[model samples]
Target: MTTRAGDRSDGTTVWATPAWRERATAWADDELAAQGVRRTGAVEQPHLRPWSTVLRLPTSAGSVWLKAPGPGLASEVGLYPVLARWAPEHVLVPYAVDAERRWLLLPDGGEVLGRRLTPEAADRWHLALAGYARLQQRVSRAADLLVAAGAPDHRPQRLTALLEEVADDAAAVTVTDEEREVVARARRERGRVEELAGVLADDGTPPTVQHDDLHRDNVFAHGPRVFDWGDAVVAHPYASLLVALRDTAAPYGVGLEDPRVLAARDAYLAPYGGPTAATLRVVEAARTVGILSRTASWLRALAPLPPHEAADVREAPYRWLAMLADGESL
Candidate 1:
């Protein structure tokens, strides 16, 4: 059965339903028990969306988090073991994973980065991105295995094809006439999209695992370990900067050109060769293509939801596509 957020048109609601919660709770308890841990209090549902939901279990050991993803994100269940093996120092390997149920039991990774950028947090940001880049470099060697394990394949060369697929799905992008025009214009710019992808591919930084939604909240403050791999993809490594720099800097009222943002960018690029003009151009191109990668990921997340259930965020993919209509960096 497909798990959706709150769609009960079929006379059933999967997420948050009594039976679903019971099963998830039983599984989480079993997983905890296997590790010699016992729950000390009631489970709490902290986050719920069309794509996934999270449960917080207070335990003898501390707090363990249980994540149950919607049908669209079932791959994330399988990616945890792979990430744990590849970047053990940079991620919390799940305590237990139930791939068939699309659930993961993870230990409470420490505090997350502060919402706003402070002087003290700047170094942590730099360290997080730098460490993440190193992890990407290592993952590049096993890029194929990443895709095999369920990370979306967003390689530079494949971006235009992804765009083409989304564009043809008019139902997915067209909410208004203007949005339709946005899709039409994006389709015509297919060549430009392919050209940018080529630039990124030729830049010599091999495609690797990119946390398409990498930002402050996703990185723990301790190891500064990165988590939340549901939005991950195999893409140009620099493509990650789109979210790391732009999204991270936004809450602080800074743009990518801001010194702090630039510092973090340089930190990540250091492993790839620092921020020379050539590398910066590659960064810009990667950012441009990264918008589509975000779009593709959103499309996947939104695919299995009923129209009403997806209503609030359904415009996301087209909105990202609209950024490309002006041929500007997103």
Candidate 2:
């Protein structure tokens, strides 16, 4: 059945090639039949979403989504239930979590929201940002439990260390005297940068659920249902804005100056006095350092890079460090 991955069929079955794909599908079929539904069609989304296998299955009853996440993502399984308790409609409600097999049968999440803008798109975009903020606020109240459940800590404790590390890392690379001086200035000015992030959802403030990746495809068009919590972190929620701003701005073909884009920013910042130049700076700083964090994570996942080529592999992230040292906004 696994002739190829992301295969589509009008027939009553869907196949994917996750390590657990076959076992997960058989379990899904058994579970569906127990509910008196029979599978009729299936298709896999072509995109690789972290480490899970996503499938769309048509059944006698309705569409069912199969997500068999890898071991590292067990936290996401529990997060769905947590969201259900926090905000009922905020995320898709999984019908069941086969904890032992590490899969979930969920109601189909609809298409990605607004690939192109419509007049109505602006309103939805605003609402999605506001909704994201509210979700973060709610999760902030439960930060301890979430961290216990394995959400990451990207607060000032982490950021302060990151700044120091970036400075050290950049120094290891060749830099001009001016850039070195700039890095020294950054170290001295680190307190203010920490204060900015700390005042948000970082260490000093209540930690919130920050969705580090919010590309349009990760969000659904119908209810704007957000999926793929694999990279969710309990960090400064402003970090989420970095990804949001880039993805949101791209489709509108306008910079942050545009009214619609500004509205979206305002909506996201409504609880924090709306968007301002200062807030933009915080957003930029958080994501700029985040570039290194993300790079390190990706490298770790693809770990044990040949020692000889390791330095070459690290050049891009070192360059990001150089940018951070120069105080250049990402």
Per-candidate TM-scores read 0.93, 0.71
Clashing pairs counted in every model: 0, 3
Off by over 4 Å in 1: 1-12, 170-173
Worst 10 residues of 1 by lDDT: 3-12
Which number leads on TM-score? 1
Residue 81 displacement in candidate 2 (angstroms): 2.5
Over the stretch 72-154, how does candidate 1's per-residue lDDT look in tens digits? 66778878898888888988889999887788999999899866557778888888889999999887888888899888788
Off by over 4 Å in 2: 1-19, 33-37, 42-50, 70-75, 99-101, 162-205, 252-254, 271-273, 276-293, 296-326
Error of 1 at 182 (Å): 0.9
TM-score, candidate 1, is: 0.93
